[model samples]
Target: MDDVKPKVVVDPSAGFCTGVKRAIATTEKVLEGDGEVFCLGELVHNEAELERLNHLGMKILDKNHLSRTTIGSHVLVRAHGEPPETYKVLEDKSVKITDATCPVVLRLQQKVKKASEEMQASGGSVIIFGKASHAEVIGLLGNTKGKAYAINKKEQLDSIDFSKPIRVFSQTTSDQNEYEDICNQIRIKSSNLSNGNPDIEINNTICGQVSRRGPALEIFARSHDVVIFVSGSESSNGKYLAGLCKSANPLTYTVTGTGQINPEWVLNAKSVGVSGATSTPEWLMLKVAAEIEAMI
Candidate 1:
């Protein structure tokens, strides 16, 4: 009698989102071309993908390195975007830049800039519901001239001065439910502070692609006996989505690549689901699934 192999399924919805794909394609095209292409940040969150790009002649640089190096011909902005100051500095240095900022993020920046202008004269403030140091949030803050406040968690809402007008926005990859709750709480807080005359403006800035993945991944996770969520350790979206999978199914495990897959995790499983973050590559997930298949 032959031993049975556990069925493996890869999540169709997993892999790069539109913004990340756009950035990677832009970087690849630049890399194929001329002298040197420097990416301001890790082009994408996946270490494997970054390593591949590095081999193809893409140089990763931070602001300090970019500022000091005056010889580069092109600096590629990742999908997360950069502050206005980053652009100004690059411009002053006469460095040509290939901006791969996501369309969604660009639009959010514009909205935040406009809202900041609207509230500036009134002593009002702009607040963001996102990780304070996230690249996107940092870029968003640039639109507000460093006047915006970032709320990493719900408890941080108390820091806002409700006496003044407020404009709120969210990072594109932030959880929709959490963002909504933040908005609702802001509204409630504002009303109580302003005698129900709150001058609050709220913008739904979360990306549709990212928001949809949460529920989709949850459903996919529950359908399988065990789940392998692949993503780079540095990817914030990966961490969030992996947590969602674990919530849906306790047997879920996270790995950066096929190399990180644990044989024990897949043993005795009847079905396995392989999924990844938006920064994760489709091929990587396929590889993970293949590895799991081989195990059984």
Candidate 2:
């Protein structure tokens, strides 16, 4: 029998982003301590990573679940960040807080808040390009006193009154191309309205980390016969990355862990590639690669 060897190509962008790295590092540090450590939310989007950390004694707590837990416990904030009110509620319960919000997101939140305040002062509306229900979107909206409007598609731009001045921004992990498309549509619509005002101000607030992943994943996907895209099912960016790969190569498969891999996907393929989202860990990808190698 001929020795079957599978070539594995890993995406350059397939590791933890700065925010997720920081959150994981903090969680590891807390786990080393003597106290009972609790995470305000999932430390990262990857289920495998969460499960590994949970094994180390890190407790994941949700809003309702947190309500049932004892007060004055140590709570670590995840990368997605929380609204100021969440902190206040925690404080009321005397919970000690350790924040691990992604620095990029932290900066974006500050910029959104500051820009919103400036817009409110100048009688302009704050418009965000993002999923309305996302926790990050909620945090951004909270900065605007609930006055901010979210636009997920080009059609949402029509709801805006062009007569009024507008300031636009997006969630850090949003699709960059979509963000630009919406901005262009808004500008074109505002131009035709003849509201007797200046040009609509559009701010490209999408993070460079998220924006750079598209091309990277595209290039990596093209070099392999079969591509495996790993990410937590809950991660929007992970799904987007997988979609990019699928568009580039029809043989792309999305999985949350190594156990999801089917040997049949690589039966006739020699060069198999693996990639993951910013929230995914490098160790997980290596494990998946090892699993594929064993199958060969």
How well is each residue in 126-181 modelled by candidate 2, as lDDT tens digits?
89999888878877887777777888988877677777778888898887777888
lDDT of 2 at 97: 84
Question: On residues 1-296, what C-alpha lDDT tens digit does candidate 1 reach at each position?
Answer: 64777799999999899999999899888888864688987889899899888988899998777666575578889999999999988988888789999998999999999888888888888998898888999999988998888997778888778888999898988877788888888888888863774688898888888778988999999999999999999887787788899999999999999777778888889999999999999988998899888888
lDDT values of the candidates?
0.88, 0.82
Evaluate model 2: give its lDDT: 0.82
Q: RMSD for each model, in Å, please?
A: 1.6, 1.9
Compare the candidates by lDDT and give the number of the best one.
1
Taking all chains together, each candidate's TM-score versus the true structure is 0.95, 0.93
Q: Which predicted model would earn the best TM-score?
A: 1
